[model samples]
Target: MDAAVNTPVVVDSNDDGTVTQELELEKMGSTLEEAIVETCSMPLENRPRLPRITLSKRNRAVVKALSRMLIIFLEASRDLCETDLILFGTAMAVCRIIGAKFSTAGRTTAQSSAIPAWGIIIEERIATKMDGGGR
Candidate 1:
């Protein structure tokens, strides 16, 4: 092994003294939230040519809460492997690149039942990708 590889070095730091990995991760999460909000706020004609998804207002709140819970789980629990974090973060960025908002905020329920949360959806996607790319 190289001496440099064995050496302990501070990878991320600053004079502000706020440069820990978790702090950076938290900043990333906030940026994600901002991105989601911004993309959701955009007009349809201005959005990309791919699928532009929308959800009812209440569903939007629920999805946001579920994703926040997923983030909490990813950080709070040590169960996830390093690669899993990459998948989760990329999934988030893509969909923050993958935002959602109802073109018209709904006055009624999106559905009568609560099932298949965003975390579950993400889990399924990850599993499929890890399992070699088929639905």
Candidate 2:
């Protein structure tokens, strides 16, 4: 293969029976060439794209609450495996990344509640929105 300029080749076919060939060779590094060939040779169907997330606010709040619960479970419970901590850390990271905020602006009736009542309230609000206020 002869090294040609870095221009994308266009192969045009005629309606009438005629054969035309255009090949462009690129001067790429050994690793890059290998990578390109490997990537190109792979079946397009097998190369899946990332899935989109369409999370509702209630879902976000639930996820956040679950993360908090997991953290609590990890902290309060004894004899947790190293893997549990890893999972908990990952969940915490995700909750923070989504930026699920809980309203702590006002003192609630259950302000002295020990079981993260604020987080629960936020989660309820989120759940309500997700459910279209069904309840």
What RMSD does each model have against the real structure? 20.1, 21.8
Q: How many residue pairs clash in each candidate?
A: 1, 1
* CA-lDDT, candidates in order: 0.41, 0.37
What tens-digit string does per-residue lDDT give for candidate 2 at 32-127?
Answer: 233233334444334322223347543343344334434533465456443344343333233323333322232334544645878888888999
Name every residue pair that clashes in candidate 1.
95-98
Model 1 misplacement above 4 A: 1-20, 48-135
Q: What is the Cα-based lDDT of residue 77 in candidate 2?
A: 41
Model 1 residue 5 CA deviation in Å: 27
Tens digit of per-residue lDDT, candidate 1, span 1-135: 011111111233333322234543454455444544444555534443233445544324333433653554446545545434433333334344224322233233345334458867887889998999875
What's the lDDT of the predicted structure labeled candidate 1? 0.41
